[model samples]
Target: MDAPTVSRDFDVVVIGGGHAGAEAALAAARVGARTACVVIDPAAIGRMSCNPAIGGIAKGQLVREVDALGGAMGQVTDVAGIQFRMLNTRKGPAVRSPRAQCDRVVYNREMARRVVEAPGVEVVAGEAIELLVEPGASGGSRVRGVRLGDGSEVLAPAVVLTTGTFLGGRLFAGEWEEAGGRMGEAGAARLSRSLLALGLELGRHKTGTPPRLCRHSIDFDRLEVQLGDDPPQPFSFRTGRLDIEQLPCWITRTNAETHRIIARHADRSPMYRGRITGVGPRYCPSVEDKVMRFADRDAHLIFLEPEGRDLDDIYPNGISTSLPPEVQEEFVRTVPGLEGARILRHGYAVEYDFLKTHQIRADLQVAGVDGLYAAGQINGTSGYEEAAAQGLMAGANAARAAQGHGPFVLDRASSYIGVMIDDLCRVNPDEPYRMFTSRAEFRLLLRSDNADRRLTPIAEELGLVSAEDGERTGRKERRIRAAVERLRSVRQGERTLEELLRRPEVEIDDPAIAAALEELGLAADEASEVEAEVKYAGYVARQAAQVDRMRRLEARSIPAGFDAASIRGLSNEARDRIARRKPLTVGEASRLPGVTPADVQVLLAALSGGR
Candidate 1:
């Protein structure tokens, strides 16, 4: 028998082509690594497996950060966005976010195009079933390559597992169960076995999507229209403006009748029927869960979102479920404006394997496994933004490790992405983790508008951002500084424009302020940033002070291979947790579960070599 054909060696192998896989492969290749992205289907590389929306609340900040780090999500969303809105526009700048409803086909196509066109990136059509590993000099096995289902092997020093909801995936619809990932994709059943065999513990997580309905079948006249933002802002800094035609979404409320239908069939839902044992995102509950949990509420809002400009399918946004097809149709028809709606597809739940993130270090590398990394849903995160951010970090770190460079670490104070990773690794979330603006303690400084300011220079230093991108970012920064100076110098009444703008009643659009911004040639977005920074300066400074004090603990690095078990005063739980997590900094150790402040004090003394 002939041996299976073997591919040439690669510097990095990215498994699965979901959001995380796409960003990981692109980032690694962009960093000059010889990277190969192995996917079950090349055409479905960036398929929007769930909702076709990008960025919301804290998630928007993440996408911005990813873009600033030279990731592709922001750009793709710009091209595919149909309806753009700045969420929380009336709120403080810290919570203000940009969200876009994307044309799923366009978004996926654009991402796939970029991935396939990326330099040094190879799109390999295959299902990776196993990781090739060999005993390492450091005691643990080192990742060598990946083994595909076709029996072909592609050797690489680094491998990023971003398999998403495909590993050991099992879909549930009412009492029905099937082995699949997304709608039509196959589950990577063999890969789950491989991970388990490697002694990696895997947890189960489930997420569901709302049913897609035929657009023509819905009664739109009865629903309230939600218009896109006028002069919409694009997610990418590279995008000057979004000139694409905007589409309107319709808002309709689920009536008591709708709730009754769902309640009657609640027990039939896979999510409620004991069929799905995996934990789902508590923040994004299903219709059944919503009805059961929020029983006092008479109705719920559902946004009828267009799937695409050319497509006739509509997504009912707020009623995701895993109920039967008939039940779905019945409840959907009971909605205020969906009385005649026809189901394009029934919503279903997918339970898949995810690695307990605590086993994954802050840099996204799997603990005790050299050259192996994990990202996205596989890392127990619930959103595309979270996955992409993790992918960027994991891929960059993997490349750095392959090239003998140091791992890139981000702290909670610097970026929302940093806060997310820190939270994931230390919290060891029991439910699927989702990002929220409330999660960031220093969100005032990590606003979506200034993501580039916080991350671009660092990305440039790491070779992830291009010189041209760096120059553009520098120019923007200069414009912002000049604007700030002018605002401070120009006086209206006894107060300078900056001081006046700080007043709650004084608006940035006031005659004097607008005139100054116009004369400076400062764009509205730029002016908004300047105003926010100045107005919130005192609050931001206080937050920065807190961050600085915390940085002392963060700067104190725990010795590599430190014996946490030997710590004399720690509780048994703290000792075990610290030993298992191997936290690199005193800050990280303090955040770990079971490690109390007193334990941290003890740790501080012991690590200082004074205990």
Candidate 2:
């Protein structure tokens, strides 16, 4: 055999090219790192591994935050999105979110194009089989590079693992099983072993996708049509306008017959048969699980969403399963408006390994290892938006670490991304972690419309924001400030426009407010944002005060490399957990599972020169 090929060095190396890896590579390169994205198939970058959509509820807020941070997900969706809707329009401003159904093929193409054309990024078609590390003087290992399948070794100071579900992946369809990350993709078995050897704890999680039906076979006349918003709202602050034609999705329901068919085949499911030992997500349960758990319910909604404009496949949402092919066919016929449904692909569940998030820092760096980071599904988060957010943070911080910069950490009071990172580091989620409005205590300050305000400045500080992006951000800020000042100066019925907006019955589009907005030349979306700020001013102030009080606890710092085992007045369990996690602050130690408020007080007193 010929000698193994050794590739040139890069500053940062990113493995796996899904949403997480794609964003990671892009962010690293944009931040001036010589980055390489190693993937099984270069063309599969940012492939929609599950549904053909992005953003929903709290997830939408994350996508906006990613865009604000000079990341590519938001801009890409603007180009590939086929349908857009603003969720929670009837709810409070803090809860409203924008979701988009994208054309899968176009999304992948655009994402790959970005990775390929990025200035300092190189896309390499190779599978990484091993992680190379060297022992540091401090008795810890630091990442040196990764070994690829083609007998080529790529060297880098920092390595980001956005491996997604490919790490020891196994797919199941009823009684049938195969080793695959996605439908036709191979699993990363060797890398999983390498990770185990490196001493990182791994746990298994299972996620499923619904079957794809032929669009031509479905009778859409009997289904309810769901149209896009009248004036579609783009996810990115930089997207000037969406000029493409919109598509409408259809809604159908599974009837009693559908339930009966699913129930009869429940025993054949890998999940129910005990063939799959991995824990599945509780929030997005499969059809069989839902049917058995909610036997009293008569029907469940099934959305018939088009996969792409050119593709004939339809994604049926809310019925993900891993049942036999025959059972899937029989159940499709039982659903309303799907009597003649043709299966383009069978729904299957994939079980894969994920590292426990407690081993990760708020900056996305893996604990006890220098120059190594983990993000995306490997961190146990369930949504594409969540993965991309983590990837952006991880990639940027990894590049910074390689350059000897301080670790970049977001505070919980600032953005939803901060809350997510804090949650991952503080608690080990029993189920797959998916973001929701209820999880964010400071939702009022983390509204979807203002992610740019909260994060772009930070991105600029980190050298991720470009000149063009900074200019756009500046323009938007000016308009918002101008509009708010105009509103504050004008009076409507004895109250200023800003004060009038605080009334529950008033809207930004009210005659007086609209005329003022027109004079100020503010866009409709911009006006809505100003309206939210004015209406929620008091609540925002109150939340900010609470944040100030909490920051005192955060300010009480613990010494570096502080040993929890050395502290007194702590429970055994609390000591064990704190020692393993190595929390940096007294506040972080206070949030450990078994740690009590009294324990926190004792730790604070001890750190402040008390016994």
Candidate 3:
């Protein structure tokens, strides 16, 4: 006899328990939705499958934004961070970002704890093999829930799919290939068919990880040591201070011999041999790619990072590859300090299925499928921070959809989250999308130091944050405003203190400014915000005006039944693209690929009855 099918009900169901799913579940619960998170292995929740670190250039800004919105990633990072550093210290504040090397095991356990202990959230140990859908009253399919591998079903009004590199996943190391997502975890083999059945377009993307070496085997003395900042900064605004002892990472480089070995075995690589068909990230290419692409370069930097304070494994930050195990062994030995290193786990690449970003709306909901949403790597984005941000938005939106509310959407002028989602929705990436500071046009307004100032209000309005947290952010804002006004009034020679601070060379600690800051009694973080505002007042004003103009354009609505083909002077390609996209606003139509400024003008004319 067949096993009996068991059924359970939830307001929202989240599939996959990686960074994205954990945040999704937590966000759903925060929104008062009874959420169920399905995971193949309950112990692997929030697993850092690739790098054992969180936050980088543009990525740190994302983590801060997530935290500002009351997301758990920043808090968990603070609890588990072994080493914290602020990158790009000499650069402008817009590019400065915080990064933390985490205790991977602790990060997972802590995140899992938050998800499990959160009210209204249930952690289910099982693999989701199918999505339950029914015909909608509006003549389209809507997600009803998900079906598990063990003949059980979770019925919900909304579903969030945050399957990080697990759908149709295949791992490759040299000549060896396996059907798994990570080193030892089996892939979600049947979920791809379910997604395709709903008419969602899926594409392939590849990401790889470096080998883990036994810490004791590494000749640490031979490598140059890279230490955390003297006063390490935390990723979370809630973290008062970093109290734990920080660990040091070491750096080495792959020499000419290493490149030569990789080149000799290039044909053996799955990617080069045509076994892996997915497009990999351009910025974080594998070792073979680096060697082959940059043939003139003789060396590539590698950082040896500890997986945890007490663990025996150390991750080599570069040299990710899928060359056979023997070839991996050969090239790794050629690195200066790794000559005596023993590989605890060989480096490998995993190619997985992801939905094309264009198929999802800005709210992360599948375009035509009501109540179905996707986030993280499944949306063609790579990085834990990106995944976490998407998860938070997707979960919150799914909960709102269940409650019969409108979607919460962020815009490019507001936060990095808005920029990422906007970029994803407007264009389909040919390769995996990774966040970078350069990606934001208004990055100067989206600095990491002021994430709370930018997003906490939105979080509070959405009930994602506590009233106490909202009050705290308000106090910080008040202090910053008071400080800026005080600076404007205080005089230094003929100019005000604010004017002096704008000179770039004059810091807040300058004798004249320090006295004013002392009188204000602002905290370090608050003072920094004041400094940035005063220093870049002119640029900030310019950007704010630009934002206003963009918002005005966004406010101009496009009629649902408007005919794009009726517009004169529009290119044939632009008209066809606009008609098919059916953009809801003038601003969105302008952003679509191949839709030129001339096309937007014609669209505006048509909306104004000029055509």
What TM-score does candidate 2 get on C-alpha atoms? 0.96
Runs in model 2 with CA error above 4 Å? 1-3, 555-559, 567-575, 601-611
Q: What TM-score would every model get versus the actual structure?
A: 0.97, 0.96, 0.96
Report the lDDT tens digits of candidate 2 across residue range 1-611: 24567776999999989989999999998888999999999989999989989999999999999999999999999999999999999998899999999999999999999999999999989999998899954467888999999888888999999999999999999899999988999999999998889898899999999999999999999989999997788989889988878899999998899999999999999999998898889999999999999999999999989999889989999999999988999998898789988999999999999999889976788887778899999999888999999999899988888777777777788788888888999887787898998999999989999898888888887888877787777787899999889889998778899998889999988898888878678877778789888999999899999999777877776765677798788778888987777776776777777888888887887788786
| Residue 406 lDDT, candidate 2, scale 0-100 | 70
lDDT of 1 by residue, 1-611 (tens): 24658766889999988899999999998788999999999999889988899999999999999999999999999999999999999899999999999999999999999999999999999999888899974577899998898889988889999999999999988889999988888899999999888889999999999899999998888879999999899999888888989999999888788898899999999877788899999999998999999999998889889989899989888899999988998888878778888888889999999999878888888887889999999999999999999999988988888888877889999999899999988867899999999999999999999999889999999999999889988988999999889889999889999999999988888899888878778777788889888899999999999999888998888877799888899999999998888888899899987889999999999988977
The residue ranges of model 3 lying beyond 4 angstroms of the native Cα positions read 1-4, 557-584, 598-611
Encode model 3's per-residue lDDT on 506-593: one tens digit a residue. 9888988989878779887777778788888889999999999898878777875778887789999888877766666788778988
TM-score of 1: 0.97
Q: For each candidate, how many residue pairs have backbone atoms clashing (under 3 Å)?
A: 0, 0, 3
- The candidate maximizing TM-score is 1
Candidate scoring better on lDDT of 2 and 3: 3
What local distance difference test score does each model get?
Answer: 0.91, 0.89, 0.90
| Candidate 3 weakest ten by summed lDDT | 1-10
